[model samples]
Target: MTDAAPSPDIAVLLADDHDLMRESFRALLDASPGFRTAGEAGTGAEAIRLAREYRPDVVLMDVRMPEMDGIEATRRICADPDLSGVQVLILTTFDLDEYVYAALTAGASGFLVKDSTATELLNGIRLVAAGEALLAPRVTRRLIATFTGKGQPAGSPRGLDEITEREQEVLVLIASGLSNTEIAQELNVALGTVKTHIGRLLNKLDARDRAQLVIAAYDSGLVTPRSR
Candidate 1:
């Protein structure tokens, strides 16, 4: 008996204004296993349209698309109830772009530096696709540091009323870029307890993932960027 053909499960949409950039990403995905390119979009408008058409597992969105910016695209994608399963991973030249906070606010799951190594990029894609956790700790720290003002994180942190004191503490550490293990050590609790707090935070805050948890913490003003 002949076996059926295999299909890559993680469908990815590449959205970038640059042809070369899209081609590069396509090549990388082509070479990697368990991934396949669903489609390509050279503009934010196109990205949104294709997102609805393809409903890929993840969209590698460039922030500076021609007709529409990725932030706007991300906002639309995230807001659309039909595209709930799709995750947007912002693509930018700098790891700590001024748009990182905006992208997160607009509903991006994580950031992907264009010049990142293949391993890092692939891992980021997989992580976002899984919706398991925040993409990167170092990048998360940089984002918080860049956006969160000294003494107080930017924006109005909301939904504090819904969670307990310990959950609130976990949010602060998450915003501060502490891993679950690190948070466990700092709080002198088991790692599973830290995970439980995060789970509660995610549920109470209506956040999509750890990335959104950081956003919520900043909005709530629970954590502030450390001074240099």
Candidate 2:
């Protein structure tokens, strides 16, 4: 009989100040299939050290930590050319708007509230490890509000002068929180076509993922938040 192929294991590093929380996360991840604990750190500095040592695929980073905070750690990890493949997923109990924006700006692949279900957490890790941005709906709304609260008018943003009009339309739809499938449906095109446009958008804007593209869209005044 032929043997089945082995599932890919995702290495995760847990960085939290609380001992219990770290233990819980380790247990949860270890119990789940296709995931393994790389190591655990009790402080941001230690997290950075272990990241350099283990080069984990994803870091479950707590927002608040001793020695350094997760934001700074994320920034350092992302800035390091050696750790470019390592993605940081910010885990925090607080849903403060500042933390959300700061984490993303510092290059976090995603953010999750501590109260998230085990399934949600696991899915988030997987999404981020696969080079996708995992922005929660609530978090998305907050991000839009934080920027558009300034009451600035929408205008053309830089880096968009190179893309075609169709690409621009796709980007605006992306900033509006539409998935590729939804975009394809909305544009009356094939899903593959939508993905092609997204790829072109990413290349033209020099964005790492959809979340960064959303930020750029807002920053460039290509999209604005609807007034409540």
Best by TM-score: 2
> What's the TM-score of each model vs. the native?
0.88, 0.89
Ten-residue stretch with the least lDDT total in model 2 = 148-157
* Candidate 2 clashes between residue pairs 3 or more apart in a chain or in different chains: none
Off by over 4 Å in 1: 1-8, 133-135, 150-158
**Which regions of candidate 2 deviate over 4 angstroms?**
1-5, 147-158
Cα lDDT tens digits for candidate 1, 1-228: 899888657999999999998999999999898989999999999999999999999999989879899999999999999999999998786644778678888889888777799998888889888886544677777777776664444555455787898887888888877889999999999999998998888888888888888877766666667621
- lDDT, residue 129, model 2: 95
